[model samples]
Target: MTAALAVRNLGRDHGGGQAPALDGLNLDVPAGSCLALVGPSGSGKTTALRLVAGLEVPDRGDVLLDGRSVVALPPERRGVSMVFQRPLLFPHLDVLDNVAFSARVAGASRRAARAAAAPFLDLVQMGGYTTRRPGQLSGGQEQRVALARALAARPRVLLLDEAFTGLDVALREDMHELLHQLRAVLEPTVVLVTHDHAEAAALADSVAVLSGGRLLQHGDAGRIYTRPASVTVSRLLGGRNEVPGVVVGGEHRSALGRLRLPTDVAVPDGPAVLLVRQEAVVVTGPDAPGADAAGTVLAVRAAGARRALTVEVVSPGGAAVQVHAETSPGQVFTRGERVGLRLPSSAVSAVPPEDAGTEEPEIADRRTADAGRMPRTHRVASPAVPDAGVRPDAPGAPRRRNHHGDHGT
Candidate 1:
């Protein structure tokens, strides 16, 4: 299939204390496909989208549409539509008028614009809301109208920048479903910028992970999440239970024990870190066969649908490892209870320790340039897992962890 949008060697630099927001990025969005850009706040995911929307231009590289260059096109001339984080609707306009705004701006007569927008309003399940003004509509309703407006223009591509931020879960799901359905019917290329994993899992055909102004990995959502290219990508995609260990005998040696690896990945022996998704790190009884016990319970808390058990590793020098599994909070044990922690080789991705953060709350950088020439293997453990140290002030931000033996809450 021809890509609806193609970006090549895209580089946008805003000189400051910080590096370029995007550095030599390349991506392809297939026609009728939805791609989700996910990363930390400063990763430059939004900047890429804006560049495509013609809201900003790249200092280097080009943007293409249907295999043709559109880098020089103006926002309106490029035939692209964008919905910002907030629904910037005109309060005085009724729902239909709000949705028809774009078509009208494009010189469609009022009657023609409204006629063109009616079917789209119905498409978003907001058909009857046409007469209500923006002030009378709820947040979700306003967003749907905004979506309708964007679609009414019948652009070649649609850009959504954190478009569902303020809505509740149910509403967010509804909007996600609406976008999926519209993708098939309208067949516009879709690019969504979001920090929400579940949103990316639900809506995207592919996931592009960015960090510190560079793309870390891009592939089908399931593959990218299950087997990340780097430890940074794994952590960003909600994988927890990172274990610091060494590579020996063609396997990864963690405090829990050594597990054989499938790929060498050229990671040298000695100090290294292995990343395991919480779902993959199962909890077995202390005496269970294959149990590579290491830690004692520190704390356990209710984690939404499951329990988050925080344990302090007594072995490998006492850093903490937070493990989440299918257990009840009511089944909690007191601190200092001996427990067996097992990380099956298939469950963990052995990455260089250099990719792991030294402290909590620090953003991971994916840029290969300027990385340390020497990879060190330290005998360290996190007092609390990096993510657990996330300040309450920064929601959805990365936290810190000690690698020695301290696990996090």
Candidate 2:
């Protein structure tokens, strides 16, 4: 299958003695599929999208669209449409006209443009708002119309730059589902740039993690989330357990405990870090002992549908390794209380020390020293476990909802 969009060894420099915003980054978006680009601010994610859209040319390498090198093409000729964080609509144009602007600009008659834009508006369920002007429409409505506008352009690839950032949770989720459905029916290759992992995990066919102007990792969302390539990728996905340790005497001595590495790295015996996901840390007690367990609960907070319990586990050297566990309704613990925590064989991952920054240990990691030795092992409650980050504190959690209507991710 031909790639709908491709970037190879792409780099760009802004020319003021700063590093290139985009360093030798490469990625391919299969036709009729969606890839989510996620990273911290200033990670060059938007720059990459602009490069693919032909809004900006790379300083090196190339961008190919539909198997053709379109680096020299203008934005209009690149066969792509971008929906930015804020919907850019013509103030004087009504919804129908805004949605039809692309076609109109391409020499289609006003009547023809409206006719062409109708079905696209209907796709986003904004058909009835066609008569309203941009200023008269709500933020979500304006975005829906923007989607229609982008679709009417008949682009082979669609770029969304945090398009739903200003909407409420319910509206944002609705847009996410709408985008997926549109992709399935329209069959356009879509690339969504977002900082929210939950959004990426929910909407993307594949996710690319970008940092420091480089593509850190790209793969199926589930696999990437479960097994991130490095500590950065793990943390970017909202992982709470990043324990830096060293491989000594064939054992990985982490604050949690000294355990043999499940796999070997090319790096010979030295300091390393373990990237563990909070979901992988199972909370246990005397009644429910766990493997390589050692920790005392530091704090626990009810997080919407699940509870977050922070624990500090001790390493062999008495250093602290803080880890968080998502507990279910029946499972609960309190601060300063000893609890068994389990790191399933599949949960622990070891990466080089450089990727794991030496920041102040989280509250849970500090309590690991007070934790006891003599680890306990617990049996799996359900051999077959079927289950289910961010975005506001939700209704139950303490959070401040801003007037701009943006929620935490």
Most TM-score-accurate candidate? 2
Candidate 2's displacement at residue 87, Å, is 0.9
Clashes of each: 26, 3
Model 2 stretches astray by more than 4 angstroms: 1-3, 247-251, 258-270, 289-291, 315-319, 355-409
> Model 1 over residues 1-409: C-alpha lDDT tens digits?
2248999999889777668989989998888888999876667787888788776789999999988998887676677877765666666678897777666666778899899989999999999999998788899998898788788767788888778876888899889888878877888888988877878988899999987778889999766776677667776786655678788966876555567765724567887777766665656566778765656676665556666666655546554545544354345555567666676555657677653344223333322211232212112111211111111123322222222432110
Any idea what lDDT model 1 has? Answer: 0.70
Please report how far candidate 1 places residue 10 from its true position, in Å.
1.5
Error of 2 at 178 (Å): 0.8
* Native RMSD of candidate 2 (Å): 11.2
The TM-scores of all predictions, comma-separated, are 0.79, 0.81
Candidate 2: residue pairs that collide = 255-314, 255-315, 322-365
